[model samples]
Target: MTQEPAEVFAAFRHAESLVARRRPLDALVALAPVLAAEPDAPSVHLLAGRAYLNSAQLLRAEDAFRRVLELDPSDHYARFALGKTLQRQSRLTEAQTQLRMAVAMNPLPEYQEALGEVSARIAVEGGR
Candidate 1:
């Protein structure tokens, strides 16, 4: 079953709206068709990752973000999201590495902030 690109993009927008409204499960549900139709699409995976992250599904979010990186290694947003997911899971070292890479790639304020936060967590948790 093939879906039109426009339809897939529309679903993505709908899912984003659902996520922004804090209805993660609903977002996931809304994204189902897009996910099925565009399994390898980085934007679809990124949106799913965000919904999962907002819902505290850390592992799922991590996988989705990783999938985006696997598809496009230069995707700084995916790196930042992966870093945040790892941070939420208390994998501070991994988070720090990803966040650093994201900041180096894009130098966005959010990426830098996440990197700083992850580094602080490592510092505190490492007892150094």
Candidate 2:
């Protein structure tokens, strides 16, 4: 039998609650099934990416963020998360590109801040 969308959404929310409670492992475990069933859900991918990031699983975080972008190219949150993940991995140039795209998409102050920070890091790295 097919599960209801509401059930999937509830599970996603519970995963988010786990992340909020700083139980990233639990969050990941809770989210895995939902993600497998709803791979195209951008919000689910975004939350999973965040949980992975918080757990320092950079590659998994990157994969989750990439899935979000693939499902919805215009998702600023996904772009931002991807950028942050890249930046943490020291892929400054790639991170900057993603950050720029995110800023162009939304122009939110937070995006601007992240873009500026990444740009500065790139510039500083280039100088070294």
Candidate 3:
């Protein structure tokens, strides 16, 4: 039987609640089935990426964020998350590029802050 979109979204919501409770493992487990069934669900991918990131699973987080980007190329949040994952992995140049793209796509204060932080780090590293 096919699940309704609303049902899928409800499962995503539950996964989000688990993340909010600091149960990222549980969130990931809960999201797994939904992700397999709806691979292109941007929001689910975004949240799964976030949960993985929170759990320090950098590669998995990157994959999830990349999937989100594939599904919604214009999603600034996914771009920002990808940038953050790159930064965490010490891929400074790539992080900077992604962060800049995110900032350009949407000049939100958070994106600007992340860009500024990445810029400062790059400058500091370059001076060393």
TM-score of each: 0.92, 0.91, 0.90
Best by TM-score: 1
Q: Put down candidate 1 lDDT per residue, 58-114, tens digits, no spaces.
A: 999999999999999999999999999998888888888899999999999989888
Tell me how far the alpha carbon of residue 111 in candidate 2 is from the true structure, in angstroms, after superposition. 1.1
RMSD list, candidates in order = 1.8, 1.9, 2.1
Clashing residue pairs, candidate 3? Answer: none
lDDT of candidate model 2 versus the reference: 0.90
Error of 3 at 17 (Å): 0.8
Of models 1 and 3, which has the larger lDDT?
A: 1
Q: How does each model score on lDDT?
A: 0.92, 0.90, 0.90
lDDT by residue (1-45, candidate 3, tens digit) is 677778877888899999999999999998887887798789888
Q: What is residue 25's positional error in candidate 3, in angstroms?
A: 0.9
**After superposing candidate 1, which stretches have Cα over 4 Å from the reference?**
none
Model 2 CA deviation exceeding 4 Å by range: 1-4
Q: What is the lDDT of residue 74 in candidate 2?
A: 89
How many clashing residue pairs, candidate 2? Answer: 0
